[model samples]
Every structure is written in structure tokens, then in C-alpha cells.
Target: MGQLERATEATLARGARLVHAHPRTLASVVALSLACFGAAAYGIAQTAPDASDLPRRLVTEIVAHEDLPSQLEALAGHELQLYRSEQTRAGDGAESLLARMGLVDAEAAAFVRRDPLARKLIEGRAGKLVRAAATPAGQLEELTARYAPANADLAGTHFDRLSITRGADGRFTARIATVPLATSVRLGSGTIRSSLFAASDESGIPDAVAVQMAEAFSVDIDFHRELRRGDTFSVVYETLTADGEPITWNHAAGRMLAAEFVNKGEAYSAVWFKDESGRGGFYGLDGKSKRRAFLASPMEFSRVTSGFAMRMHPILNQWRAHKGVDYGAPSGTPVRAVAQGIVKFAGRQNGYGNVVEVEHGNGKSTLYAHLSRIDVRQGQRIDQGVRVGAVGATGWATGPHLHFEFKVHGEQVNPLAIAKSSEAIELSPAERQRFAGVAQQIRGQLDAALTVGATVAE
Candidate 1:
């Protein structure tokens, strides 16, 4: 007998009174629902048309058949040809290469070994793309090998096609032809899990493309020192193909068209562009050139072994101020000029070993020391990125490494600092409009590249 019980009873009584007051209206709602249900039930109860009463139609056509014996004879007369493709191995010879492709004709193998043009397949560099056609009976019908052009200068634009075919007289003939290479645009993206090279490899990016990415962002990020685990990159690049097959030669990798690299939380972008005068370079979307007065590193990619600081010298075994930066790399790795300049000195120094010194104007100079071989000579004018020498340990020191130093007015300073503080090339006012259009197109491609990379990573 609480107040709550009284309120509940009053609410129920009010609802009952309302229902009684609207009885006719409620009856109409119930009757309408019943009519709808009756209609649905009647539709469900209706039977389908009787199968015997349904209309039916029949149609027939004649098909000619060949006699079994004639079919068998025709199949027997047709020689089954099998096609197989493989990459040439380092030590592959005529017999071994053909055997791997399921070809067993001794005559074809003999011609490959004796013919001057045919022997080129097994010679020179390995990894050439080879395709062969053979009969079911193991007779070689034809073979074609595509590799880098014979002329080194033409490698980027052409490829050498070697064909060995069986003639009607049962003799094998070999011919070599230089064919122009085809170009295709390709997109790639990767996240830096461990290193740039590792991420690029996981994304199926070519090594050359990865190197180009590093060079593209070299001004903003020191790949060797500033690379982080979560850094990511997207790229649009050109690929050279021989007869629709991507070339495997190192020299055949085409130039990078555009790239976007996100290091840490900041993103940097670059697109390759050529001006009216045909002078080409990488520029940002804002129309600023990425090329500076000098490159951060003399080598494309290498770790800094020693910095410009006071430390125990590896050779002297005593604490001394190291004026130059030491980069650890494999022996014979190409060393490039840091900036465009004339070679002031290119010869052996007492402690520096085989060194190349280039004097940039305005009292600025750079030195590359401990080279295994010098490619440039004194008084030779070389541009930035021109190969000057190869890494070596020729001085009074340890293993193979390149010693790099930057000087301003005969005083040694940190090369990295000088490279970073150098002036950047800017685009002309006339070129900005044309560059904006190219930048817009490249931005979309880079976004697509990022999507592709994320899918691959997953």
C-alpha cells in the first residue's frame, strides 16, 4: 500500500479508460490488420500452374564430327612444341644451358658452341633472359637470348637479341641484332623497417630505384645517419624493357621520375624536370631545386665509420683530432665528386694514399682520400657525382674505407655541415608554371604508389 503502488494503479486505470473510450478506432485498426493478413494468406495459398498445361518448345541442330582415326592421324602429324624460359647462369655452357631448358639436340648445342655469334650467349655477363622452343622429341627448334647491348654506351637505350634457329636444311643458324629498348613507367612504395634497401627489396623495387630514392632526398635526409625505422617512401620511375621483358642489367634501370619520402613526421617531395634549354634536375613541388652546392656523401650509400672529432686514431693508436670523415664500404666502391670543380690534386699523398682534391671556387675545396684507383686526373674539370676514384685502404691505416674532407680557405671543417649549409638551385620564374602542372600529375601518382606499398606491406 505504498505511494508507488497507488501511482502504478492510477496509470493502468487511465490506459484502460482510454482504450474503452477509443473502442471503435481500435476495432478498425484490428480489422485492417486482419484484412492485410488474409490477403497475404490467400496469395500464399494460391497454387502454381500445372506442369502439363504449361507451354513447351523443342529445338534441334546437327553437328558434324570428324572420324576418330582421322583426328588421331592429324594429332600425330602435328609436332608438339614446348616453350621454356630461364636466366643464364654464371658458368653455363652450351650443353648445360640447353639441357636446363629441356632441349637435347646435339646439333643445336654444337652450333651454339662453334658459331661466333651464338657463343655470345654463354659469354660475357650472366643473368641474360633466354627463351627456347623445343619439340616433344627433345629437338631444339629455336632459341633467343636477350641481354645488355654489346656497346656499353647503348645499354640504356638498346639490348642485344641473339637468335639461333634450326633451318629447313637441318642446320642451325645464329644471328645477333641490336634492338631499341622500350620504356615503361612504374610505381613503388616501401616503409623503412630496418633499412631503405631492405624495405625496397620487400616491395620488389629494383636496387637502382632504391639508390635513386636515396639520392633524391639526400639533401633533406642523410640516409646513412638520419634514416629511422618508420620512414616511408613512394616513387614513380621509368623502367627499360627489351621486347616487353624488364631488363636485368644494372645499367638498364631508367631514371626516377618523381618521389615522396617521409622521414620522421616531415614529408619531402621531388620531381625530375628539364627546362627549355634541356637542363634537367630534381625540384620540389614548391618549385625549389633539391640539388645543393654539394652532395652530403661522396658515395651513394654507406655508413659513417668515423666522424670529424677527437678520438683514438686506428693507425696512430693515440688520441688525435680527426679532420675528415671516414666511410666504411666494400673495396672498389665508386667514390664521386661532392661538387663541380677542377681537380687540384689527383695522386698519392704521404698519409692520405691515393687521393683526389678538387678546388671549388670561392676558396672552397674538397678531398677524397684512400682510393684504390683514381678515375680523374689533376686539372680535369668534373661535375658533381662524377666518379673520381674507388674506396681503398692504401694509406697508413686499416681496412677499406673512404676518407672525405671539406676545406674553406685551407681550413678543414665538417663536410656534412658544409653540404647542408650550401646554397640550393632555384627554378626560374618562366619555368614555375610548367613545373606546377608536372607536380600536380606526379602528386596523384605518388598517392597511388603509397596505396600500393601499404597493400604490399600488409
Candidate 2:
């Protein structure tokens, strides 16, 4: 056993000491042991202890994995519960899952404590799911297995890893772990002023991606409040690499040009740039940083129904820091990766629920939380303006909304105001004709669509 394992074992021993002192359980245990000996003395082996003496009905508890609980619940369980776990080591599960089912209150711990060497072998870890069941006659059962981490590095970092198991006697056990993660992510920048869905549909960017594009530029444009009748944008950015393969974006670059908001009677234009210099930042056409201390959301046009502040947490009632902005909308609303990044997290989290964290270079990161469904996975590469998940209340939320957050190093910052305009790439005179051809094709499509709509109206 390593020093770390020994330390953990010693700590658990100290906690379980009180349970060993209770006379109530000792008496029942002694009585049971005597019965075992009595039967053994008569030639019956203790290996086959009397089952009739055990309880009739049983209760089992399972944690983490969804499949095991159903299997145990299928048994004639007297009662069963599925609870979250807090274990942090490999062997923490060995006994916890079955304690209730085997009616063995810390028996696993008791045995480990009795044998210091065995305790030494208990720590160090792996992932696992745990199940605990109880019998009417008063017995607990447990079962646990080594679990594999989706991200090997996360084995000890995500603390609630769990597993389920069953004993030959039909008892169930549950084990839990205790590694929690504090996350950071990154996003790219771009702008689209055309109708939300249309822009994405035309660009081959998903609706979620369009929404993200809108959100990324919202801080500077006030998309809901500020936009023009004719606006254009240009961009360049990085994509996240997973297993050495780039699949998604981690950051982006670009400009919003000629945003002709007729009502606003203004044309908005900006050059967005990512400062590769250690100073790190986005800039507007005026060379000022539009990046606020944070980003409003990673998604675009989702509508900021909730801002960051103290509010009633949909779950775990009480005031809590709403670390991100919430965009209220419908389920399955496409959520885009705000920047080029590798998905560091793509799973359920406390309060945040279904979440994805992207890590951009330079300690800058972004987070997309409170999602109903995730389209990506841990270590997956993503591009800026790519669909990474969908908006919905998967965690502690009041309704369908995307929770967007920006973090520098580890601190949250406003995503808006991040000057996305740095420098606009111009089509070389040689490439101008080619670019114009593409532009004309788009213009032709727009004209056709408007004409058809007019005819239909008439």
C-alpha cells in the first residue's frame, strides 16, 4: 500500500470506531455467531449459514450507474434507494454498498480496521458504482467493482463515481466516490446579423451554432437590443484537439460589418482579434477590449432571462451564485461551443446539470451548463460556432435555458463586451472575384426567397 492509501485507511478506521463500540449490534452478532457454531458443531458448515435465520424482505441502495439499480430493484427487495455517493478511494465501496443489504453496518470497515494490512490494500482507486440493499429480517448486502474513468485523469477528480453489486444471497450494495471538479473552458468569436435560423442554415452552421455566434457577439452588439438591416462578419479561429484530433473549436476571430439596424438607423462594424501576445484578449475596431469580465452565454439569441447573481437555485433551495447567464427557451435548443476547445467536461454536474467545459489556450476557458442533452463528449474536439449540446433544464433550473459562463484562468468574466473585432481579413484582389461569386450566389438565393414570400403574401 502507498502512503496515501495508508492515510485514507487510518482515517476511515477512526470514523468507524464508534460503530464498533455499540453493544446493541455486538449482541446480535454474538448471537448469530453462536448459532453458526451450534450448527457447525452438529456437522453443518458455517459456509452454509442458516438463511431462514436471516431477514425475509430486503432493501438495497444503488448509486451512479443506472443499470444496476433496476436489476437489484427487480429482486424481491423489501426496500431500495438510489442515493448520490461521496467516496474518494477504490475500496471505499467494498463495504458501503452492501452494508444495508447485509445488515452489516460498517462490517467491511470493521474487518479492515481489524487488519491494518488489509486496510493498506484498500485505498488508491478506480471508478465504480455501488448498490446497498436491506432485508426485512435486518441484513445488508453490498457489491462493488472497479470502474473506468471516461477521462483517465478524472478517476480521482470527479468524486461521485459509483457502481452496484449483488451478493449470492440477493442482497444489493452501492459504493460512491468523492472527487469533485472545479471547471474552466474557452470559446471563439464571430457575428451573424441575418435572421438567427437562416444565417445558420445558410452557413451550414447548426441553429445552435448560430445562436452561439449571436451570443458571443451580444456583449458588443446587444443583439436583442442592437442590430442592423444589413450586417456581415468575417472570422478565423482555433479548434479543440482530442486524442490529437481537432473536432471542435476552442477560440475564434472575426468582424461584424454593416449591421444596418434600420430601426436603430446605424451600421455596426468591428474587427475581432485574439491577442496571441501574453496580454491575451479580444479587441474592437477602435483597438479597445470589448471582452467584459465575463461572457453572457456560450449560445446565441437564447435570451438572457436570468443574469448572474444570487437567486433561488431551482434545486438545493437557498441563495447561490448563478455563475453564468441563463437564456430561456425550448428543449432541444441547439447549444454551440462558444470557442475552439477540447471538451474537458461533458457530463452531469451538481446544479449545472448536463454540462460541457472547453479549455482554450492561455488559461482562458468557457462553460456551457444546464443542458438537456450533450452532443459532444469529454476529450472531443470542437470548433467555434459548433453545436455541443442543447438548452434545457437538466440540473437546478426553472425552465429551458442555456447557462453560459466565461472564465479566465479560473475566474468568471462577462462574455459580452469582449471586443471581437481586431482585424478583418480582406479578399485579395486576386480572390475578390471568387469571393464575389459566392456572395452573388447568396444574394441570388436571398432575392428568390423574398420574391417567393411576396408572391405567397399577395
lDDT of 2 by residue, 82-173 (tens): 33322234455436534423445455455444553333324545323333344454343433323333456553333233433455865434
For lDDT, the strongest prediction is 1
Candidate 1 residue-wise lDDT, 1-458, digit = tens: 99999999999999999899999998999999999999999888776676799998999999999999999999989977789999999999989998898888889888888999999999999999999888778888889999988898887788899999988898899899999999999999988999999998888888888887788788799887789998889999998888889898855486789999999889999999998899998999999988898998999888888999998988779999999899999999999999999999999999899999999999999999989999998999999999999999998759999999999999999888888889989878889999999999999999999998888768
Q: What does candidate 1 score on TM?
A: 0.80
Global lDDT of model 2 = 0.53
Candidate 2 Cα outliers beyond 4 Å, as residue runs:
1-220, 225-259, 263-265, 269-297, 308-321, 419-429, 432-458
- Top-TM-score structure, candidate number: 1
How accurate locally is residue 432 in candidate 1, as Cα lDDT from 0 to 100?
A: 90
Go through the candidates in order and give each one's C-alpha lDDT: 0.90, 0.53
- How far residue 453's Cα lies from its native spot in candidate 2, in Å, is 13
Off by over 4 Å in 1: 1-81, 250-252
